[model samples]
Target chain A: MHYFIELFFSGLTRGAIYALIALGYTMVYGIIGLINFAHGEIYMIGAFTSYIVASVLSLYGYPLFATVIIAGAAAVVWSGAYGYTVERLAYRPLRRAPRLSPLISAIGMSILLQNYVFLAQTSDFISFPKLIPDLPFMDRYADYLGSSDVVILFTTLIVMGILTFIIRYTRIGKAMRATAQDSTMAMLVGINVNRVISATFVIGSGLAAIGGMLIAAHIGQINYYIGFLAGIKAFTAAVLGGIGSIPGAVLGSLVLGLTESFATGYVSSDYEDVFAFTLLVLILIFRPSGLLGKKESQKV
Target chain B: MLKLQNLRAGYGNIIAVDDVSLEVGQGEIVSLIGANGAGKSTVLMTISGVVSCLAGRVLLDDVEIQGLEPDQIVRRGVCQVPEGRHIFPQLTVRENLDMGAFLRRDKKGIRDDIDYVFTLFPILAERRNQDGGTLSGGQQQMLAMSRALMARPSLLLLDEPSMGLAPLMSKQIFKIIKRINADHGTTIFLVEQNANQALHIAHRGYVLENGRIVLAGSGEALLTDPEVQKAYLGI
Candidate 1:
């Protein structure tokens, strides 16, 4: 029972990271019909940004909490700029091109970002400093739950609440919905469609940055390639719930995380991702629109 | 309220609207009739700034609007009820109306206008919270018009409002169009292949054949013109 509780909390914490990243993917895909393949790289950039900020600020004798806070804001702003640049340079020109064109461009952008980071930040894993006050308990949760699991669960809940507020009540939130629903019509009604699209990418990338930073800080390590596995996992979570649905992404992340954790804990660890892939395949074969996505039908 | 001079535009290479010139005075209904390929829709799109002009000018209330983006066009009080009733399908009827007033900042005025739209289309009020996609064809048309009206445009460009409805529904839609024009004192630029119905509701009408205007006259004159009745109106 103690082991079960520990695994459950651990999975949820992991799931929260996936959910954060997945929200960005799902939101961008929902409003603008592009997959935004370089999104993963933006998260990697955020982690690196946090690293640089933390290192610089600590050298100046900044407190750990202040360093993390300042670094998180830098992550959001820089990642948003990264998203805006990608939209302006890569996706804007091909807006009217064939769907495959943008998809291919996204993949190319991903490769370019990875190599760019490699040239700039080096390819090897680096130690992520302990920014959070993690007082590890060897037996506090061993009899009830794991100490790491508690931090993971609590942190995600706070992040989720903040995200939920931003997406629900803000004026920009309404604009995002209008842009996603019918862009042409939205444009006709005096919406700056381009601005909204840029805003979507920025917000999505910013969120993914926070997720990447959290993951790096929690696990104590990050590399230029860290985004690859996290990206795939989060994409799976987005697909699990429904690609365009925000709530769906969150639910999907939890489901994916729990499934992977249980599989790793009880069954063979090697089969964890295999189970996720299998779930995706089965869902696609049976419910291609995803578990929460609505099917669009043409009037013609 | 609106004028177009030598407006030429297209999707890519094919010029859809070729040297099309037309005008709508304040509180008048001007209809453009043509075959499917005669560029009626292209003219409306160009005026709304969705399609760029190769040459010529579009003026709304004496302001040059050509070369502007679509949203800027709407801000100039020129709104379009596009072909296919492109209301946000997933949104509720009320939400669809709210999106129309997206540019407006006055809360009380917005509320008043929504109530006004519901009054104009009572059936929409009854189904305000229902998904826009669920409304019947005629109801959808009314909702689309209401949504456009939420923008409070001086000029409303309607494309093929009677496209997919039954004859009875089409008649009702035309009647609503006439009423909306009369009550709101709005200038209308209507594009349609339904020459007979369109002519019935216009103060003046023009016929386009092969990307150019071939006929122009008062509504009654165009309806009775022997050439128009024979080839275009299908008498």
Candidate 2:
């Protein structure tokens, strides 16, 4: 029973991270119908940003709490800048081009960003500073849930709540939803569609940056290539839940995280990816539109 | 208060609105009537700045607006309800109306306008919380117009407002169009393939043929003209 609880908490922590990253993919896809392949790089950049800031702040003798806050804020802002620039430079010019063209541009951007990061930051993995400290109350539950896991889960919940509120009631959120539904009509109603697209990129990048910071702190390591695998996994989660649906992304991530955890716990860690992918294939075969995706309906 | 001078625009290599010039005075209902391929929509789209104007001037009260972005043009008090009543499928009717007022910052005025549109189209009021896609065709038309009205536009460009609607619904829509104009004192630029009804309600009407304005006259004159009667009114 204890062992099962441990795996479950671990899976929940992983799901929280995946949900944060998957939201970026789903939101960008919802607005533009384009898979922002470079989104993962944004996450990597975020982790690196946090790493550098945290290291510098600590070196300057800043308190741990202040250091963590400053590091996380820096990560979000820098990642947002990168996200905005990526869209302006890579996707905006090809907005009217064939759908395949923007898609190709996205893949090219992903590769370019990865290489850029590699050249700028050494490929060697560096140990990340523990930004989350142990809680006094968590000492009793430490066997099942670590302090970092608790913080991650709690932060994700708060972020999700804030995001839901923004999308449901805020003016910019309504504009985003409107643009996603029918961009032409959105324009007719006086929405700056380009600005909305840029906002989407920035928001998605910011979320991924939070995920990057949390996961890097949890794992205690960072590298330029970390985003590649994490990005693919989060994308898989997005697709599994339903690419354009926000709630679907969260549900998909949880399912993916739990599956990986249980499969590793029961069978073997070596086949963890195999189980995760096989589940995705089965779900796709049965529901091509994904679990929560709306069926494609054409109006005559 | 809108004027177009030799407006030439279209897709790449194909001119949809070729050398079309017209004026819609403030508070007048001007209908541009034509057949399926006559470029009526292109004219309105160009004025709304959706399509790039290849060559020509689009002046709103003497201010050139041809090269501005679509949203910027809308910000200048011109709003369009394009063909097909493109309602946001997932948005509720009320939310759709909110989108119509996207640029407006006056919260109380927006609220009053929302109430005003609900009174104008009571059916929309009842379906306020329902997703727009689930509405009937006639209801969707009502929602689209109400959405446009939320902008409180000085000049409302309507493209094929009667298209794909039943005769009874079309009549209701036309009646509401006139009411909107009379109530708000708004200038209207209406584009339609349904010539008989458009001409009847219009103060002045222009006949477009193959991307060019072939004729212009008062509503009664065009309605009774021999050439217009033969080609357009199905007389």
Question: Which predicted model would earn the best DockQ?
Answer: 2
For candidate 2, lDDT tens digit of each residue in B1-235? 9999999999878899899999999999999999998998889888988889999899999999998999999999999999999999999998899899999999999999999998888988889999999999899999999899999999999999999999999998999899999998999999998999999999999999999999999999999999999998889
What's the distance in Å from true for residue B58, model 1?
A: 1.7
Position B223, candidate 2: lDDT: 98
Q: Write one digit per residue (lDDT tens) for candidate 1, span B1-235.
A: 7888887889888988788788899999999998888888888888888888888888877889999989888988999999998989878998889889989999998999898888778999899999998998889999999999999888999999999999998998899889889988988889988989999999999999888888999989999999999987788
Kindly report the interface RMSD of candidate 1, rounded to 1 decimal. Answer: 0.8
The top-ranked prediction according to lDDT is: 2
Fnat of candidate 2 is 0.89
lDDT of 2 at A105: 93
| TM per candidate | 0.95, 0.98
Instruction: State each candidate's clash count.
Output: 1, 0
* Tens digit per residue, CA lDDT, model 2, A165-258: 9888997899899999999999999999999999999999999999999999999999989988899889989999999999999999999999
Question: Highest TM-score, which number?
Answer: 2
